[model samples]
Target: MSFIGIKKNITQKDTAEKYIGDVSTYISNNYSNNIKVHDIAKYVNITGAYLFRLFKEYLHTSPQQFLINFRMEKACELLKDCNFTTGQLARSIGYRDVLLFSKIFKKSFGISPSDYRKQL
Candidate 1:
């Protein structure tokens, strides 16, 4: 068989799993920055459409949702410490608008940042 055919012998499921892992790692490492699906797709040597489809199929989440969830989780962790203001915390977690961050935070945890900190 030719090289192309040989390479094609690899299962699509395996390739999708590997790509999803790579994208997950990329999101984990860069969650503090504004990352887009196209950027991740480029990093993994795939097209944006393919990346989206793979993420949806394997992770049941879009890349953007994954990033937002990651950021919110990080924000919750940081909220335990009282060093940063809400704005600073939001910015640190890749949110430029504190109000928007608060909205997302409230939606994710069902409480405001200040209240969450108070509980800690």
Candidate 2:
């Protein structure tokens, strides 16, 4: 490839990386709120479909999956500290339904939230 083509490729890659970072940061900062792929795409100034493709290309995961994993990881940290009830944790992590939160948590960590807390 020509130097100009190489430069364009590098710039595009950088932009893609920035978009991924922006999306990840937004999710981390707003995980307590109801976030959608559309919302994230808007925040990053891209269409939802494009954002999905970018995530798949760069992170090998869907946006929704990334959000789920992020929330679950946060839940694990909060559980370790023992600062909140399951319901509170659920709500704080953007899950209005405690049961749903528990289900996802168990699926991710191989233990219920209460059981995980107990182990901690």
Candidate 3:
């Protein structure tokens, strides 16, 4: 008889949870650009692959997605009070391309940065 079983590994969801918390803390405390998946895994004592799997399994998203969302959310907050152009805003949020930032910002917020600021 042949049987199939699921792989058993990394059962402690708490580790992944801790990693998420640590990653968030690191992003908040350090520059947004510094929060890479490798750095996050190193900070949480996990391999990059393991951390990626953990985030996908529990959060249903990749670490990059989380970081991008976090950055965009912060940018939205700053947009309300700051008068920086889109290029400046992109740089402030660790985005190297103003065009790319605008595309992402528009997709996430349903408006470009300029439009968002005008609403504020």
Q: Pick the candidate with the highest TM-score.
A: 2
Worst lDDT 10-window in candidate 1: 4-13
TM-score of each: 0.83, 0.94, 0.78
Candidate 1 lDDT over residue span 25-72, tens digit each: 998888778677778899999998888898788889887788789898
User: What overall lDDT, based on C-alpha atoms, would model 1 receive against the true structure?
Assistant: 0.86
Q: Clashing residue pairs in candidate 3, if any?
A: none
Each candidate's clash count = 0, 0, 0
The predictions' CA RMSDs to the true structure, in order, are 3.8, 1.1, 4.5
Evaluated at residue 111, the lDDT of candidate 1 is 94
Q: Is 1 or 2 the stronger prediction by lDDT?
A: 2
| Candidate 1 residue 17 C-alpha distance from true site, Å | 1.5
**Highest lDDT, which number?**
2
Cα lDDT, all candidates: 0.86, 0.93, 0.79
Q: Compose the digit string of candidate 2's lDDT tens values, residues 40-98.
A: 99999999999999989989999999999999988999898767999999999899999
Q: Which candidate, 1 or 3, would have the higher TM-score against the true structure?
A: 1
User: So what's the TM-score on candidate 3?
Assistant: 0.78
Output the TM-score of candidate 1.
0.83
